[model samples]
Structures are given as C-alpha cells and as structure tokens.
Target: MDELEFMRGRVYGADHDDAAPRPGRVYAELVGGPLDGLLLDVTDRTERELRGGVVLPTEIGRHGPGGGAVYAPRGPGDRRFDWRGDVP
Candidate 1:
C-alpha cells in the first residue's frame, strides 16, 4: 500500500501490529499542495465540522510559520480531503 493508505487511522510515531484502521479512529488522506500524502485524524469531528473543512499548520507551506493549509472533504463519502490552498 502507498504511504497515505498505510497511514490511515494511524498516528505518527504510534505502534501497531497491523495496517487495519485503528478502532474508534477516523482519518482523512490529504491530497495536493504542501500537506499532500499526510493523514489528518478526524475521529472527534462532527459532520458539520467536516463539511466546513479544516486548516492544518505546516512548516513547509508557502507562508511558513503562522500559516496553515486548508483541506476539505472531496464529497459525501470520500475519505480523501483535497487541498484548497494556504492561509497566513
């Protein structure tokens, strides 16, 4: 599996016995832009929150510190979030 798929439901630095998604956790694969291929844990997010999208901090984005990358759900059932752009 690709990096994105492998990281599903898995947090960075966490240990697991298998590739299966962890129980009670949800993840969204980021696509495009600086944060591409990263996974965002969204287990605690409400449907309304998911629909509204999120901004994640990134050190490598165009604006550097104090900047964030925006990502939004691709659709109703999709697990991938598309990069909208960056914000300072």
Candidate 2:
C-alpha cells in the first residue's frame, strides 16, 4: 500500500520550525515545506496527555529545535481544531 493509504487521510501539516506541537496531538510535515508532516487522532487522543503540551516529533527526536507547546484543552470554551475532512 502507498504511504497515503497508511495515513488513512489523518495526515496533518507542521513546519519543522513551528515552535512546538501540542502533546497528545499529531502533526505532519509538508513534502516540500520546511515541515516533515504529522498525523493525529483528535477524537481518540487522550486529554490528559495534552495537558502537559508536546514538542513536534522532529523536535522531540532532536531533528530540530523546540516544537510542542502547552496542550490546551479542546473543550467548548477552549481552542479546538476544525476538521474539514481534508486531514490537514
């Protein structure tokens, strides 16, 4: 199967220098952009893990600098990502 198939349309975008990726959340780097692309499942991701925030995988791996940030709750009053079905 192709890589896209593995993503199952859960692919997300992220600049390798995007400061930081929220913990519990996933990010996808762009093919040509400075990012390396990330993937996440908001619906299934645990809320507790997000509380501490997260650095992008690349950053966590030391491939780059800081990335993850304080993971804000996606509650009704908090900032939440709007899924457009485009994945990222």
Candidate 3:
C-alpha cells in the first residue's frame, strides 16, 4: 500500500522531515514564527518510536517547518495531547 494509506488521511503536506517526539521528551515545542516558544503535544515517544499525535487531514491547519504539519484538537478546551505514550 502507499504511504498515504498508512497515514489514513491523517497528515498532509508532509515532505518527510516530520518526525516522532524524542524519547523522554513528551512536550512538542514551536520552533519559530508567532507561536514560537509554545509547547504543543505531550507525546512521550522516542525518535525511533511511532507518532503519538493522532491528527486527521482535516484537523491539520497548515504545514509547519521542515515538512511537519500543525493540527488543532477536535475536542473542546485547550489542546492537550497525551504525553504518556497513549495513542488517541
């Protein structure tokens, strides 16, 4: 199957630079732009592990730096991604 099939239409505009969170580092920080210094998801996956964020194509608002995609949580309130290695 194609790589897209594996994503299941969750991520978009991905150019391959995107990567899973490093081990022990659960919080995702904004590298640059207006949202710089911002801490995003708390996924506790290592670089060699799977992506912990479960975002859909429709959920992604735009493409981030280095081909990484940015997505807003579907639920209400502040966006808080699971940091304990829990997948959606």
Best by TM-score: 1
> Which pairs clash in the backbone of model 1?
none
Candidate achieving higher lDDT, 2 or 3? 2
**9-58 per-residue lDDT for model 1 (tens digits):** 55422445643557778878888887776667778887788997888887
lDDT of 1 at 12: 28
- Candidate 3 structure quality by residue, lDDT tens digits, 1-88: 7543344322123343564334464454433332333345444444333233333222222443323333333233333332221112
In model 3, residue pairs whose N, Cα or C atoms come closer than 3 Å (at least 3 residues apart or on different chains), thus clashing, are 23-46, 42-83
Between prediction 2 and prediction 3, which has the larger TM-score?
Answer: 2
TM-score of each: 0.73, 0.27, 0.23
Instruction: After the best TM-score superposition of candidate 1, give how far the Cα of residue 80 lies from its true spot, in angstroms.
Output: 0.5
Instruction: Give the number of colliding residue pairs in candidate 3.
Output: 2
Output candidate 1 Cα RMSD: 4.3
RMSD of candidate 3 to the truth, in angstroms, is: 12.9
Q: Which ten residues in a row have the lowest lDDT in candidate 1?
A: 11-20
Full-model lDDT for every candidate: 0.75, 0.37, 0.35
Model 1, total clashes: 0
lDDT for 67 (candidate 2): 35
Q: Of the pair 1 and 3, which is ahead by TM-score?
A: 1
